[model samples]
Target: GGAFKETDRGQWAHVVCALWIPEVRFANTVFLEPIDSIETIPAARWRLSCYVCKQKGVGACIQCHRNNCYAAFHVTCAQQAGLHMRMDTVRDSVTGAETQPVIVQKTAYCDAHTPSISGLTPNANYVEDTISEKTREESRNKMKQARKMLAKKRSSVPVILIPTIPPERVQEIATLVSITKKAQFIQRLIAYWTLKRQYRNGVPLLRRLQSQGQTHTGFGARNGIEGSPDTSELYHQLKYWQSLRQDLERARLLCELVRKREKLKVALLKTHEEVVMMRLNPVEMAMIKLLDVLFQKDSNEIFNEPVNINEVPDYMDIVKHPMDLSTMRTKLYSKMYYSLDDMEA
Candidate 1:
């Protein structure tokens, strides 16, 4: 009845009650956000009778996070009784194999459920890591959905690996690579996604290593060979993954080599053209200018026209090689003349 706030979901909660609960958050300072966080309190908590108030407080009750302990209480009642409630920051397990860990807030409703602070003695009954379990559950559900979607036979549908990593890992990889290493990082990430080559679970490289215990068999378990050969499917499975990894490494090396070859090809072409131009074009240009001046200097233009074979039948006898202005111009235009000496000849 006192100072109530309405949520976006049309649910009303007492401001005092909301303030006491560690899970409730105000989206903004000005609005004092009546965020729809009431659902975070498990529905089973409502059914459990509150030990503090001795009432079945539905919609305004929270349970003890301790395992096998169904202790329930209202936020106001818990606060009045001086209960140990807190928001703890911990590593998020959903972001698997990331270089950097994702830190998230988790509400601790009991002293027993609270994580052991560093430099403090551990609680004997603290068996479950609530945040880790929650994140894992979320990851499992998300990967399942992604697998289902990817399994469809739709044409042109791009096959994207289920990004089991959180956004922070993407940012970390972005920070790790410079603009020049863009291609290298792209290839590396591609190889990273191509793990196992099975197109099955998007389990991270590190997680996959941890999950596979098939290779952990004890040595010399059976009496010699014959009956118990070491060539089991479990042993071969490890080798299969290793071979795939080797292939991926080779592929990465090949990609790098190809990139280098492309760069070299471009550079070689440019330099070759430059050397050719430097050695040949200037001499050709000077000869062309000389030819132009000589042609211009022919005042009567006698040499400009070719001597008709009939008019001067002995012209070929006098000149061993046939030459004319028109032929020279045609050769120059077609780039058939390799040097100034050839053009002059």
Candidate 2:
């Protein structure tokens, strides 16, 4: 209420007042009680939208008494908006009346409900309006502000603190982007989304680099992305930014690897039974059966028991580590290998 004066009702009281609302005149102004009932206003006024607040069912509202104008509003709202609150005074008959005279009727009118200077037109109701001039006036003001802002437009992206890229580089990127269709010569270069995303990311990165000093320089420097000092930060600071950018890039790559590892883990779990069976080494009997092939790696004597050193005296020297298929069968029955990997090893 710094700029506002307190009324008879007190500071900010009129806004909350139920009796002091539009279409509600005080029957006894002395105590400001015994207000004119809301029943006095037409039901249509209650239903009509209030142009000022654009809401209904809040309080008693007054409407444009000008015929067919459904415009309704709170009294305070109407007064602030400068709508015509016409009062017809009772003149000369009453002797006890004050010099100000007696107001017999109080009526409100909208912008479109102004009195005709010539005479009453045939379609006076059509000329009258509701949800009228006040709402339109506000809309018009907002439209004017937007128009003013639009006047200072430019094609180039504006820089608040630091620009994303050098103006020339941005222009080069723009030239490449302007041609969207695939051209054999520029097929690799025409990455519209990549260019846009990098440009978008560069904006915040430049701001961070500028604010954080040399901490983020090394990363962008290694990648040859940081520009001249005239375009961005100094050389050493750019180098620090390059380091930071590289660290962040590594972090991004590691995150992708971790995601793939988790997916692989889930896949392994789904086929856990098959893997377990493979590790069980159930091929011991199969290997024994395969040994039946006669003299496959050497002589057919391998199917029978080992030849004794007594019969062939050179056997102890030549076949010092010999073991026949029958000996292998005995080892398999003894459970020497628990898994296929162990058996192969």
Candidate 3:
């Protein structure tokens, strides 16, 4: 009688069989005995069979090609042997890993069924090296291009010298000139004022005077007098006129410069006003228009203090051109003095 015992490994029904090779049997030897022999075995007597298909066999129990589990099967059984055997320990081409199961055919498993595992070694390091080299090359090329572009840009830039006329020099020159001596000052002022003139007026005058003096020895080059003055006297007059002309020109430049600066200031203010108005809310625009109309009414009242009929004639004439009024209104609005709604009213 066989005794069933649960071992440390798992449950097993052990039976002492008539020993065929007693000398080879070790004390630890645990034989896994099949329930039936193939010759006397009925379909019901085959208790354990192939894990893959439950078919009967004893010769060489083929392990499951998928899970490597012992699944006994006969060589000539209806079920095919090695159906899921992986002959080659290859990785799947799609997955790039060894986890994929290889499907075997009825024929001997070849590279066709079990894919070649030879070239499965990862080339990540090679790819990374190539990419790094390419990146370095591109970076180098970009740096070279940047350097070239900067050099070209630098080479193309033109040098301009902005003349800095000192304000103190301008003030000093203005003090020397009298408002009463207009014509004489205007003539003398040509040299200083026209020094930087686009046309060669100052240079032309100097050249003509020099030429005339050379032609006629009696003519004085410095003062343009009929007879030649002494060298020292001519030199002294020349130096005086030169200094005076420089001062006068500086004064004229200062006046013109002030006018230009005022114009620029007005233009900048207009631009800022336009930007602000463009972003203003509708309510703000309406308020601005009302303020502008009120300011205009006040200005008119101030001008007409004691309200003369003769003075009103000039005022009426000024308002004759509607287009001119609109243009003036637009310019005033650009300076934030009025709004479009004010002009409408």
TM-score of each: 0.27, 0.26, 0.20
Which candidate achieves the best TM-score against the true structure? 1
Candidate 1 has its poorest 10 consecutive residues by lDDT at 218-227
lDDT of each: 0.59, 0.53, 0.43
Stretches of candidate 1 above 4 Å error? 1-4, 9-11, 15-32, 37-43, 91-104, 107-122, 125-345
Candidate 2 lDDT by residue in tens digits, 179-276: 54535434444345346446665444344444444334323444454565643455565567757966886687689779867876776675685467
lDDT of 3 by residue, 54-131 (tens): 334432232222222244433222122222222234445673132344532221211112212332322435334433
lDDT (Cα, tens digit) per residue for candidate 1, span 32-68: 6656576675556567675554556454667775556
Q: RMSD in Å for candidate 1, one decimal?
A: 31.6
**Local error of candidate 1 at residue 339 (angstroms):** 45
After superposition, candidate 2 runs with Cα above 4 Å error: 1-27, 34-44, 92-103, 115-345
Question: Could you tell me the C-alpha RMSD of candidate 3 in Å?
Answer: 49.0
Single out the weakest 10-residue window by summed lDDT for candidate 2. Answer: 1-10
Task: Report the Cα lDDT for candidate 1.
Answer: 0.59
Ranking by TM-score: 1, 2, 3
Residue 321, candidate 3: Cα error in Å is 39
